[model samples]
Target: MERLTIDDMKSIELEIMDEIDRVCQAHGVQYFLGYGSLLGAVRHGGFIPWDDDMGIIMMRDQYELLMANFNEWRTTERFKLVSYRDKSSIYQFAKIVDTTTVIFENFVGKKAATGVWVDVFPLEHFSEQQGPALLKQHQRTGLLRSFAVADPSVGTNAFVKLVKRIVCPFVKNKDLYELAERLDRIALRMNAADSASTLVIDVLGEGKLEKMFSKDLLEPIRIPFEDREYFAPSGFEEYLSIQYGDWRTPPAENARPVHVMEAYRL
Candidate 1:
């Protein structure tokens, strides 16, 4: 089989997004292009030239609805939705994967399976006090994730790395699955639907809080992405500003995607 090029990857990603969009529309679940995917939509009207993957986010309630209905709604012949709830999944977030294609990233370590995939992040509610609480929860999640992956380098510091290295030998895959469940429970316990702000937990990294958006700001609005339209927060400008100051300005060439990936149709 021939290796997939950048365009091939983009084509598969777009197909996944279309599937997601269809399911969301059918069920009234709102979603938005997130992180680099959102930046690409706004700044370039499509995928960033150097980007290889896609990310989309939904609020917690809507996310739950999707999870409840995903198996029935998904393009099962072509795609599979994997979440932390799945024993085979290690990541905290969910993924919509194209089974016919494979793409691998170096940072994720060993591969249980390979496929073209888009990340599905859930935006959880948070109050001011919840920051510290969420921080603690994420710290625990980070430690468990490190052990689960058996990667000491996941932590930013030497001490945490040392601890991970020491403990990983004793950790098993089942323990990792349990940790993921705990992390999910923590997120649910801390959800602040009555609060004015929300955050996407564990999307950027463990314990890294996303920008807080007011409830009104989160109301969905249509935005042009590629040749189609998709939902984004009404306060997209504010959200983008907080996440990337002067998001309009292109970064230096050398600062672009540093890692390269290979994808292939199976």
Candidate 2:
């Protein structure tokens, strides 16, 4: 079996993203290329030379509709949708995975099953006035996101793995998602149009910049990516600034993003 190189993985992810674009467009579901994916569109017009991951953000109702009618919208046999609702999933967000390939990841002392995929996230909202509470919530979200992974052998080092084995075992798999659902209830708002600002997945972002923007910039705009146009946040300049300050400038070689994962044909 031949290993899937970075280029190979990128090709798969792009195809999956394109499918997502098609499905959302056909159904009139609005979404925005998010996090590093959005940054790539704004800065590079494609994958950021070193980044392999893809992510998109949708408003509350839009995501619910897509998930509810996922099967009907999914036109390709190569893709399968999974979310925290699934027993094997650790993420609170949804993913559209390429069924014919697999990806094995080990990073920052964690390991889990993923695949050639594009991440789908809801546009989360909170009251800007509640600064202390929002900070604490994000800290909790990042912690729970890790715990949701539920991998017993979750570390690259012996000491970390030993500690994780002791901790991750205590939480029952079903209980993890239950906790996530509880956090979902804590969401103060969901509709982007009504929100003062919007945030995507915190743990999955590049920097801890703010997603808050005046509602005007919340509308979607078309931008070039991979020689094609895709929808990005209308306040994209501010959006990118929130995710990555000075995002227009490319990072130095050593500072560029890197993913410690491998993909292969299954």
Q: What is the TM-score of each candidate against the true structure?
A: 0.84, 0.81
Any idea how many clashes model 1 has?
0
Instruction: Give one digit per residue, the lDDT tens place, for model 1 in 65-114.
Output: 88778878875569778776766466666788888987655434454345
Model 2 per-residue lDDT tens digits across residues 206-225: 21325444445668888888
User: If candidate 2 were superposed on the true structure by all CA atoms, what would the RMSD be?
Assistant: 3.8
Clashing pairs in 1: none
Which stretches of model 2 miss by more than 4 angstroms? 108-111, 128-135, 144-174, 188-209
lDDT for every model?
0.72, 0.69
Model 2: residue 10 alpha-carbon error in angstroms:
0.9
Clashes of each: 0, 0
Candidate 2, clashing residue pairs? none
